[model samples]
Target: MTAVEETQQAEAEDFLVDKAKAVEVEVPDAPEEIGRSDYYTAKEVSMHNKPSDVWVSFLGNVYDLTSVVSSQSRELESDGSSLVFPLIKCAGTDISHWFDETTGDIKKYVDPIKNMMTYYIPQGRFVHVPPAEPVSDWDNSFEVPWWKDATLKVGKLSASTRSLRVKNVLTGHEHLMEVPCEETVGQIRARYLEYNAHAASYTWKALKPNEEKELVFQNLDMTLNLQDNGIADDQPTFEALGISSDFHTPVIHLYYDDDLTVA
Candidate 1:
């Protein structure tokens, strides 16, 4: 086997062993005295697995770590920036099963600097894996797969070719916009609500994007139910709910054209 393959295998074995050990241990409840320590109580240890080894079986191929290191660090240096070592080692082959047109996976290794995996994929590709959720002490620490960051080279719609229409459920008002195809649905939604008087009138409004709003464009047909009666201006709209917009007013369903799908 190649050196990369051998290293991956060893890492996989270590992960399984650690996983088994975790399953066998039972966590003890903290003492009533909050600050008190008990010798019998179990302590948590952060798993010490290398980022690359944590990514075995991620993309179905053992990637040459040398390539990832050479490419990413070189790119960073050319820009006169320092490259962190962990980010350099999280290299792997791109292998996404979904969205056939995507290609050329680039994986950059990143150590969890603040209990979060924060890194940029090459433009056009999205990161895949770990589901963007919080990490636990026992959770595996690995860089996302290459396919998650794969970008489309061609046959995709451009921003200039698309348009968006937004309706305010409260006032029966509508706004039309020409947006780029690359803009996220959340971005369009935010812009739509920004000028909406009912949205601004709310005591609290969520100004950021939510996970439910990040659904892919293909699933735009799904219908949503709004709460607080069918009154639009009194509460958030159905579109806001899907995107987790933080408005309390009732929302009504708003539809866009076929070409103008949700992100």
Candidate 2:
């Protein structure tokens, strides 16, 4: 090849190499998750572990909690101020295990902050993440960890899925009805009474599957929580009634009749 032609080819090759290098140096950002499938790997999440860019992996998701304590000053002397940073010490770490150790129902604490969170609303600070949709059902995915409070949801952590089912057995009926696990017996009975108007006046009885003996709907002794709900308007949950894990305990039987004799 001629020297001139060789020189031109070399320049073209160098140009291509520089372009490829530019693309290689670029860091791909995690997708913006707006309540859909935006996932991040654990290694990718670790990048933001520093205090200035704190992130947390929770419930199979990565959350950027940098915003939560960003404005806090260690020197400030607010009441119980010492506790603030400590609680969020897991800022850039996977807090799922810790969070689970703290509570089974995270929404109970998270939902309260939707309208207002005095702790994060510092003096003269207008920075606040807008509230997202509230989770109406217990089984809802809306309980996204990073979505709560000032934590900016960076991305979701991929994980396996889980589900639960509840069965409602009715008296004078031959079949059991499936219900959502989070539903209370009271909610199911009210619906049953609404549909079965004739049985409305009947006293209600909850029984174990295939067992003739009625399962006493004790006044609020059991719940899927750490604390007893204390005789909730309805009885304990079917899960709390020992119907959760065992199918052998099949059919949470519900009986309602104006007369015990009729039941």
lDDT of 2: 0.43
- Show where candidate 1 strays beyond 4 Å: 1-159, 197-263
* Global lDDT of each candidate: 0.34, 0.43
User: Could you give candidate 2's per-residue lDDT for residues 83-183 as a string of tens digits?
Assistant: 23542555556655434334432322233646643223222111222224343422233334333543466666644211212233444454333333333
Give one digit per residue, the lDDT tens place, for model 1 in 233-261.
32134455675333332222343222211
If scored against the real structure, what TM-score would every candidate get?
0.18, 0.28
Best by lDDT: 2
